[model samples]
Target: MHAHRKTRPPANLGPWQRLLLLWLLGPLLWLQARHVRRITPRMPEPPGQRAGSAGQGSLIRLLVAGDSGAAGVGAPTQEQALCGQLVRRLSRHHRVEWCVLAVNGLDSPGLHQLLLDTPEAAFDVVVLSMGANDATALCAPLQWACWQSRLADLIALRFAPALLMHSAVPPMHACLALPQPLRWFMGRWAQQMNLSLAALLIEKVGRSMHWHPSTTTTAGMAADGFHPSAAGYALWAEGLSQHILAAQIASRHHPDLKPCSAAAIAH
Candidate 1:
């Protein structure tokens, strides 16, 4: 009897294979995007104050900026969204003067442009939530890297936040609203862009920027099934609060360490 051999599929496609696959599936992907857009109701940014102060005594200036999630699209108001949750969580320890500058449909380049137009200001922390829109737009990994690098540079130069927290790109594969093939493709692209972002931040900003992982779930998604529901925002806010608090403790212990400098914290 002849011995049977088991074969495993390759983990990833070659550049040529990817190109060919894209070419073949381009029309279908386009149609899927159109269909999604047509069916999904347009969600406005949740209404709330863009700037507010919380707690008292010593000030911890914070800036939250980026895309729809950061703008609190799914939640009823800003208070139920990322900014409100984050501010509330952080306010437990220090007086928080938080400002949000997020816009729906904004990408990395748009964020950079927004920052360029805003007046220079110092912030103890700047939490950036982005990459989903960039992934949906099919931004190239290299381009993503460039835009991220530029954004980091601008933040460091202008805002000079002691800690720059970059919220991880959400899991597109887990987005229940997105259909197959399109979801698979976007998920892969998002992962690539995230990898590129991590590498770029490590190389350029070092310990200044902390890459945070997303802990969202399908059940925690909003009515649109695209944005984060209130529960999802709470989970995200908890993660950010922990990171900020840990950084604060570390800063207190190391008096000589500069928050935005390479020596501030370990990756």
Candidate 2:
């Protein structure tokens, strides 16, 4: 019998066009980025328990990982953060053991290192909230895709979750905090990065992972205008919880179907 091969999605024209656009407008974008940074407030991560249990039934170990959003910077406490909301939704029918591995400013590379540094653990489900920092930093979509793949591989090797859920980068083009061309640049980059991520997931079709694109608009966010509000977290969490439950109900054994199958269609 011959083994099958999975080819990488091409280094298509989308990323190159974005790169060209960035290069042409680099100077203007840089100034805007600097100004935004100078004026933007640096909010601390919300205080809350990093680990806990919720509801009752068979065990569903959960891990939420990523940067500021994952750390729930906009919310008042950990209970109102993404992890808390996710647990609150998922716990209704199953006992959930959850822990949060997130920080305030970590990007994809930072997240990869964080996971590398943590001790081995097992999880049935893992939620990842990332890419805002990467988007803000203006990382290229192709590079972003590669880093995401590495991080996904790291997560698989370290935690071995039955399901890996990747939270969307959010719609930065509509963020209230940013101004002008900077916002425009970030928005374009963010969309490209998301497309790259969605493509990456498609490449890993055999894996039990899915991308959870933002369901709500960025207009309903927190003080930062980027990180989700408490209510926003609940909304996002509810959406994610539904997807997880649907996947589980379809096959309790493991998440089936090509990764991001729905996300590809939705995007």
Candidate 3:
């Protein structure tokens, strides 16, 4: 019997092959970087609240930042967006002035840059909804982590007294589910990235941070099936309310603010 020998592909690669390999590996590595950065939460600034005209002590000035979801892209109108609904709901108790600094496709880095570049007088509460766009960027996990760390540093240095709230990483795979191949890759990537973000939130902010586990309903999906609809914004508002109430009650010892979850509202 003749001995069988396996042949290796090659020690050296052609231009096209090398380019193809780089193309494939680049995204993979980039996505890994996103994962690592997102897993751990960063310590950013407390919201800076401008005194509301209603009376400085009586009002809550909230600042919201993020991508399309935070911008309420899928909603029918701007008034129905996240900031709108949140302001509306929060205003019931205290006068509210919500300043939304967000665009359609901003990720963590974009959000940070936006904050750094944009100048606002003050804010009492700050809410962050991002990371989906970062996943879209396909940045590597470690690189992404570095950015998150830098963001945290920036926040700590700049903002003060104002409360900081971060929404849990949304399920991006749901957005990609229609396209099978893309769905598999995006879903896995999103899962890993969300995990990274969760870890960070725990490590950096601890219990002080709020995480909104999205149970986004398809009916609440935007016409494009990507962004959240009005109903979806409602869900987000509900989640946020829980955190807000929890903190308010904890800080002021207000019995009314004790229960903040949707389940509490449902009852």
Question: 6, model 2: CA deviation in Å?
Answer: 37
Measured against the true structure, the TM-scores of the candidates, in listed sequence, are 0.83, 0.83, 0.66
Superposed Cα deviation of residue 173, candidate 2 (Å): 0.7
146: Cα error in model 1, Å: 1.4
| Poorest lDDT segment (10 consecutive residues) of candidate 2 | 1-10
Model 3 earns a TM-score of 0.66
Model 3: per-residue lDDT, tens digit, 1-267? 001222111133333543465477666655654654565333222232212222123556566667777777777665677777776677666666556666777778777887677542344566777776776565644455566666656554444324677665565545522343344354455555555555666655422444444344566666555567677787788778667755662112223223112221110
lDDT (10s digit) by residue, model 2, range 39-140? 888888888788877898877878888999889888889899888998898899888878888899999988888888776666778788889898888787
Give lDDT tens digits, candidate 1, residues 1-267. Answer: 001222121134444655676799889988998999899888899887878778865668777889998898888898999989998988888888778888899999999998888766657788888888888887776688788778878987877667788887776755667787887776666666667677776654433443333333455778887888777788778878988888772212224323222121101
**C-alpha lDDT values of all predictions:** 0.73, 0.73, 0.55
Model 3: weakest 10-residue lDDT segment is 1-10
Model 2, position 160: C-alpha lDDT score: 68
Error of 3 at 50 (Å): 15
Higher-scoring candidate on TM-score, 1 or 3: 1
Structural RMSD, model 3? 14.2
Candidate 1 local Cα displacement, residue 210, angstroms: 6.4
